[model samples]
Target: MPDAMKILLFLLTICLGSIIMQPSVAQTVVNKPSAATADTVTVRGRVTDAQTKQGLPGVTVLVKGTALGVSTDTNGFYKLVVPSIRAVLTFNSVGYATVERKLDAKATGARVVNVALHPDTKALQEVVVTGGSPSQALMGSVSGVQSQAAHDRKQKRGGVSVQIQGISSMPRAPWYGRSESYATIQENSFHTARKEPLSTFSIDVDAASYSNVRRFLNDGQRPPRDAVRIEEMINYFTYDYPQPAANEPFSVTTELATCPWNPKHQLLQVGLQGKKVETSNLPAANLVFLVDVSGSMSGPDRLPLVQSALRLLVKVLRPQDRVSLVVYAGAAGVVLEPTPGTRRADILDAIDRLQAGGSTAGGEGLRLAYSTARKYFNKEGNNRVILATDGDFNVGEQSDAAMERLITEERESGVFLTVLGVGEGNLQDKKMELLADKGNGNYAYLDNLDEARRVLVRQFGGTLFTIAKDVKLQLEFNPARVQQYRLIGYENRALADEDFNNDRKDAGELGAGHTVTALYEIVPVGAPPVVDPLKYQANPAVAPASATADVMTVKLRYKEPQGSTSRLLERALRGTATPIVQASENLRFAAAVAQFGMLLRQSDYRGSATFETTAKLAEGARGKDAEGYRAEFVRLVKTAEAARRPTEDPESYGVR
Candidate 1:
C-alpha cells in the first residue's frame, strides 16, 4: 500500500475508534449526587405545541431573571441545572407565547414541568397565508415581508429565486423560495507586466462567506455562484505566518509554488500576520450590542441563536469591559445601560429577554447604537457596536447608498462595527458586506452554534479589536521575469492603482492576531497572454528590469487604528517556484481552498480542478489541525461533493 493511503487509513481508524468509545465513556455511571441541597435542583421536562400536541424542539427554557438556560432537543426533552428550587422556569420560542412555571424541586421529589405553548397571533400574521404546503407554512411563519423583499430583489437583479427544502418537519412548498444576494463578480483578466506593472487592492479579513457556504453545503444545497468569494474562503483558515517584531504592526511572508490544478501556471502567495496581543493586555472594551428584533428574526435559528451566541462572547469579557444593549423592531431603544463585564448575568438576561416582533427599523437602530457607543466612548478602550441580524432592513434609511452613508458617518467617531448575520432565505448579504466595509469593521455569518463559538469565542480578539485600518496592497511585477498575472480572488475588494498610496481612500481593517492571504497566478516570461500582443502598443513595453533577481516588489500601506495617515512597508519576491509537495502547509491548504471555491462557482478559469483533488490536497496539508477546523473543512468539502453528486436518475437532480 502507498504510504499516504496507509497513513490516511491509520488516522481514520483512530478517529472512528474514538467516536465509538465516546458512548461508552458517556455511559460510565457517576457517583451519587451530593445530598440534594436547597440551593440546587435538577429539572426535567418535555414541551409541546398547544395546538398540535407535537413536541417542540429548540425551545429555550431559562431560569427566570438569570442567564441559565437549556434548549430542548429534537424529542422536546430538556434537563437543566437550576440554581434554586424557588426559581421560575421560562419557556420561550418564536411564534409562541412565553410560558412560566414556578418550580420547587424539593417539594416534588422529581418535578416535571410539562407545558404546551400557544402561538401568538401577531407572530402568526408575519407568515403569508398561501395554499398550505409544509415548506410554505414553515417559511411563511418566519416573515411575509422578507419573502416579498427577496422576490423583489431577485427580480430587480434579473435573477430568479430558487426553492429550497424547508427545515425538518416542513413539507416542500412549490411556491416557497429563497433568494441570495452577492455583489456581481467580474473576474480579473491576466495583465501583462510590461503593460500594467502594478496590481493593487484592499485587504479583506471577513470570513462570513466561507461559513455561509458551509451552511448551504450542510443543508444539502450548492451555494449560489456569486455567494462563493474565493478570497474569504481562503482567509477563513489561519495561516502560519511569522508574527511581527518590534516597531511593526504586522509581518509579511511570501511563497511561490506550482499551481495544484493547473501545473502550467505558477502560484504566488502573499501573507500578512498581524501582531498578537494577549486578550488581557488588550485595551478595555466598550461594546454596544445592536440586536434586530424584527419579525424576520423570529425563528429558532435567528433571535434564539443570536442570544445564545452572545452569551458565549459575554463569558470572555474582562471586568474592565462594559456592554450595552440596543434592540430594534418598530423602533430602537436601549434595553440595558453600560454594564460592567463583571455583571455577566445582567448582560445575558437582557439578551435573553429580547423577543422578535414588529418591523425592522435598522437605520434607527444604527443611530441609537452609535449614540450609545459615543456616550460611553473611551478614547483608550476598544469602542464598537456589534449588529446581529438577518440583514433585513425595511423601515428607515433603507437604500444601500443611504445605509452606507450612515455607517460611514458613524465610523468617523473612531468606533468600529462588527456585523453578525444569522438565518437565511432573505439574507441581504451585499448590504451587510457594504455596511461592514464602510463602517470600518468586519463581517461574519453564524450558521450554527459551532460557528458562533468559532467566531465569538475562539477568535474574539480578531473579530472585535482593530489594530490597523485602511490596509492596502500594491504589487509591481518585473516584466523581465513575468509575462502576465491574475489575482486569484478579491474581486469586490479591488482598488484603483493610485488608491494604494492615497490614505484618503478607505480600505480594510486588520485586527490583532489576524492573518490575510492573497494569491496570484503568474505566467512566466514566455507564456502566452490573455490579450493579443498589442501590435505597436501605445508605449511599446520596455523590459529593462534590473538584475536584482526580484520577480516582484510588494508595497503595503496602512494606518494605525487611531492615526489619520498611513505607513508603508515593502518586500520583494525572489527565487524560482517551489514544488507543490515542498510548499508550506499554509500555501498548499489555501491553494486547495481557492481551487474548491473556483470549482464550486464553476469558474471558467478553474482548469482541471475537481472536488476530489481539492480534498486530497487539503487532507495532506492539515497541519496540527487544532480545534479540528481543518478536519471540519474536509468534512464540509465531502458534504458539498455529495450534494453535487449526480443521481442515477437524471430527473432527480437537486431534488430531495
Candidate 2:
C-alpha cells in the first residue's frame, strides 16, 4: 500500500481497537498562483461571521473566472496572491449568498482587509428553524449596519442568531433523512464555543421539521437547507486514544475542495471510517442513560433523534456491559436497571416504549443516573452516565452553577458522564460544557443518523477512552533572541504561565493520534510586530539578546491516562525564514482566516489585513482542492464582504 494509505489503515485499526476520540488536523486550500509566470499580487483579509462575530473557517477568496483562489486553515485565516492586481475576488458558501470585491492597482502598499458574512437564508419554509426572522438578519451588528451603505444595510437579520429552540418528541418519520441539517447547526454553535455575541440566533427546529422540509417543498418553494453543525461531527467520531497497537480501526481525513455551487468559498470535506467493534473486548460498561423525555422533546430532532441515536448505541453493548435507563420529565424515574448489554432487545425495547411528557426534572434525573451508575460500578471496567437532552434542564438545577457542582461531585464517584445533545432551539452549551469539563467526560450533539454513526459507532473508543490528563502547553521563547510573538486562537484554552507545571491544572484533552496545532504569528526584533507601539514605557534596563534565533521552543505537559502526576514533552520549531519575500500556500491560508476573524470583530490588531489584499493572497494559495471546498471558501469571503459591501463605501463599513 502507498505510505499515506498504509498510515490511514494503521490509524483506523488504532481507532477501532482503542478508546479515545481524536481531533482533526485541519486542512486548507492553497491559492498560491504558480510563481513562474502569474503576475501574482498578494491579498490579505480577515474572515468572520457577521452573526456570531466568529471567524469563518475555510472561507475561500477567489479571483472570478479563474482557478485562482485559496481556502482558510483551521484558524479561519487565509492569504492568496493572484495573477493580476485588478482581479475581482468572490466569496460564497452553502447557506450564505455570494459576494465579491475588486483589487485595485495599488496592491503592494495595501493593508489587511476584514470580511464579515451575515446569515443569508433561514428558510422559514422548513420546519427546522435555526437563527432568526428573515427581517431580523440584517441587525446582527450595529457596526456592520452603521458601516454599510444605507441601501445595502437593509436585511431582516444583519447578523446570524444561533440557539436551541426547544425539545420536540413529535415524530418526523418522513423527513428523518434531512435531520443532518439540524445536527450541523448544533455542531457549528458548539465548535465556535458559542462565544459569538449573536443578537438573534436560536435553534427553533420543530420536531415536525424532519417531515416538514419535504412538505414545504411540495408546494413549489424549497425549504431552508439545514446548516450542518461540525462540532457534533468531530465529537461524534469515537477515537481509541493511547491504545497502542500495530494498526488502528479508523482514520479521519479532511479535504479542501471547490464548492460545487459557489466558485469563491471553499468546501471542507471531513470524513471518517465506518466500522463496528466486536461484542467481545468491550468493557463491562455500567451505563445510565439520562434522557430528557420532557414535553419539550416533542419534536423529531429532539426526542425522536435521541431515541434513535440511543437505539444505535444500545445495539453495541455486549452481554458483559450493564445498562440502566433514567428518564426525566415532571418526575425522574429509573425505567430500566442493571440490564445486560447483551440483552440489546430488552434495552431498546425499553427505549422504544418511552414517551416525552411533563416538565423537565433534569436534576432529579441526574441524581438517579448517578445513584444507578454507582450501584453498578466496576472496579476494573468502564462506568458512565450518558445524558441525552436538548439542554432545557429547567425544572431542576437550572442554573449553570448548580450543574457545575453536580458534575464535580459526579466525577468524584468514579462514574464519568457523556452528554449527547439533541435538537437546536433550547440547547445550553454553557451548562453542557460545564458538566463535561467537571465530570471528566465529554459532550456532543446528535444532529442526525450520520452524526450518530460518527459519534456512537465509528469513534466509540476515543469518545470513551482516557489517555492523558491535564494537557497544557507552555512555549518558552528565547526572549534574548526573539522580539515578540502572538498565540492564535485558544483564547479560552489559554493557560496561565504557572499552570504549565501544575499537574492538577485542568486543561484541554487530546485524543490519541489527535493533533492540537497553535501558530505564533511572530515578529522578529528586526521585523514589525502585529501589535501596535508598546502600550507601556519601554524596559530600558532589560537588555535585548545579542544572538538571533530562528525558531521558538515549545514544551508540552500531560499526565498519564490514569496517573494524576504530570509528564513533559518538548519540541522546537526551527527554520530560517528569509524575510518572506514571497508567501506560501500554508502561510496565506492561516493569515486569511485570521484576518477574516479580526475583521468580523473589528479586532484592533488586524494589521496588514484587508479584503482586497486578502483576496489576492488567498487567490495565490489554491493548492489541490480536489473536492472544491477551497474554491468555495474564496467565494464565501467575497459573498460576506459584498453582503456588507466594504467596496461601495469602505469608510462606512469600517474597512480600516
Best candidate according to TM-score = 1
Measured with C-alpha atoms, the lDDT of residue 321 in candidate 1 is 98
Estimate the lDDT of model 1: 0.79
- Cα lDDT for residue 251, candidate 2: 34
lDDT of each: 0.79, 0.50
Whole-model alpha-carbon lDDT for candidate 2? 0.50
| Alpha carbon RMSD to native, model 1 | 19.6
lDDT string for model 1 (1-656, tens) is 99999999999999999888775633553433434333677789998767545566556676665434666665568887776777887776544567789986458455778988875422211222334333323222121112233334334544322221112332211111465567888777788888799999999999999988876665455677778899999999999999997899899999899888878778999999999989999999999999999999877568766876887798899999999999999999999999999998788657756778899999999999999999999999899999999989999999899999999999999999999999887888999999999999999998765577678877888999999999999999988878889998899999999898898899999999999999999887655555677667584654535545799999999999989999999999888888899999999999999988998888988998888888889989988754546765765675576563312332344223
CA shift at 99, candidate 1, in angstroms?
30
lDDT of each residue in 348-429, candidate 2, tens digit only: 6577557677898888888889989988888777778888887777687888788878777777777777777766445555
How far is 161's C-alpha from truth in model 2 (Å)?
31
Q: Model 1, which residues run further than 4 Å from truth?
A: 1-176, 536-548, 644-656
